[model samples]
Target: MRFLGNFLTNSSRRHAAAILSAAAFAGASSIGFAAPALAHDAVLSSQPEQNETIKQLPHEIILNFSGEPQQGFNTISVSRDGNVLFRGEPRAKGQELILDVPDNVRSEPGEYTVGYQITSSDGHATRGGYQFTVDNPDSSAAAEGSDDAKADTTATSTEGEQGESNSSVPSWLLPVGGIVVIAGALVLAIKRYRDIKKD
Candidate 1:
């Protein structure tokens, strides 16, 4: 009778272990599914789109992204001839970052460049720049104005260049590690249960 009970208990343990192994496999699969979401978001379009010329400098520059950017984690700066006209304090509105040029800094025209650093929804930093020319007679002169635009595109909040934005490691590492730990614990528990059953 005791032998039958022991056999039944071991069978139950194997079944439990099989369930745990299946759970760990599912967990690993889920991690794989979520891996793609870790990619950095990209700029879909921007105000005064790339290489576009404008009659006047718009008070605000808007950037539309492929995904909703993180709030308070983005920036925009406008400059001409390396002279920064306005450093924008960008705000999030849906999938766009709106940077309002300060009143005092507006009105300059010339070849202006917009540089940005933004944190995507998945917590990746993206940085890039685009240029637009402002069509004003004084734009050429303004290009030489005081206070060169902050040319440092890679700010503390932003990543380096676009080429270096991709992550080298796989995103599933953490989740896989977690699953391994859980599986190990489950195995140890099963082994302990067998030891006690044998006794």
Candidate 2:
């Protein structure tokens, strides 16, 4: 009975050890699966966050990441219906990247698609984008405004160049005009002198 008891006791201990070993392995595997999540750079937060709505447009978009992303290869852009409203050159500060939205956007009310691409701390490239909305869905005004802005820009540039050219014209014209006038007067005087002398 004593020998049998000892054998049973040893067997129970061996079984418990086996169970503990399996549990340890399972815990390690779960941790291994979670490691990849941390290894990759992910969006921690953002301005105009995913699915957020706003009343007005902003001059820039911002992103915060779980890890520090590499610089010189990051980009941020905002668009509507594939027409880009703003594309900013990403400026990285630690784990955050700030991008400027061009003023031409004029905060038109519509759904905007914000896209981003960056090199992660792990040397991997990450690409993603999200959509946001402005309460005013009347993009027609914004569209018209943008067109008018473009026309204004074109007109301004044309005016600027024309102004420069126009301002410079009289400078050269006065000299040439004076020379022609003086030459004509001299010719007329000589003709009169010869005619009078002949008479």
Candidate 3:
């Protein structure tokens, strides 16, 4: 009888350990499944579209995103060659970040890039750029009323960097969930061990 009790106790310990291992595995799997959602927002489409050539720059530069970007700390900059032609704050509307191009800003026929930094819906800062060509041979290369164009490129850059540093959400919630699962498993195993002792 003494030997049998010892064997049963050992078997019960193995069973409890198995349950703990299974719970840990399940928690890890759940974190893996959630990894994709941890990614920041991305641009789904834009006004000019990537690499598209157009005769004229639109009055509004629109960027459609996969998620609704939050309001504030949003910027749009249009550049050609090394020159920043336009840089300004953009308004967020649902999933769209819209920049109303100032009438004074003009572009020459060449490749242009639209760079953006916005507060993503998940509260993380997201930055990206896309290029489009302007084939408007009739338009002048120099931006008209150059003196009127906002020369706040440095400020915009600084603000964007600050926003990125400030708006971070913890990338991993796995440790907390894993701990909970392990704790629960331990509690369950303890209860089972007590029940076996009583039996």
Candidate 4:
């Protein structure tokens, strides 16, 4: 009986050690899997920063990232009232991505959204967006009882005549989708670990 007890105790210790080793490996693997995504370049700052209000529309919109963004397949789009007014590839300069507003692109905006997608220096695609307001009092001149009201009306009409573009996908879609995929993978790994533990 004493010999049998010793063998069973040794087996339990071995089994517990195996589980501990597996848990440690799984923890390490999860961290490794998520490291790249977490290290992807982040926006350090923007010219027309999030929720900022400016007196005039900037000629160029600039986004500064934590690391230099890779060129190609990069996009920056500006929108107001659900209409995309400008959408184009930005000029990548060091850690800054700049989008020049077209000479003909005029805006009388209350709030505008700047959305972007860029190849991260870490080689992953990252996307995000921010909002800024253009509270140019001159924009509302057409509604005022002033001599220049008629001219303002004509300008507003011209702006309307220059039809707007629409963005089909949200800028945050990629990052959000990546997060979901990663979460699912981690859940699957954990489920497999639980099955092994059961055995």
Winning model by TM-score = 4
Error of 1 at 39 (Å): 2.6
Q: lDDT per residue, candidate 4, 142-176, as tens digits?
A: 44656577778989887776643334467789799
Q: Positional deviation of 159 in candidate 1, in angstroms?
A: 62
lDDT of 2 by residue, 33-64 (tens): 88765587988899988899998877678899
Best by lDDT: 4
Q: Which regions of candidate 1 deviate over 4 angstroms?
A: 1-38, 138-199
Where does candidate 3 clash, by residue pair? none
What lDDT, from 0 to 1, does candidate 3 have? Answer: 0.87
Residues 140-196 of candidate 1 have per-residue lDDT tens digits of: 565655224433433533655433666655788979999999999999999999999
What are the clash counts of all predictions, listed in order? 5, 0, 0, 0
Higher lDDT: candidate 1 or 4?
A: 4
Query: By summed lDDT, which 10 consecutive residues of candidate 3 come out lowest?
Result: 141-150
Pairs that collide, model 1: 83-148, 83-149, 84-148, 84-149, 109-139
Cα lDDT computed for each candidate against the true fold = 0.82, 0.87, 0.87, 0.89
Decoy 4 TM-score against native? 0.63
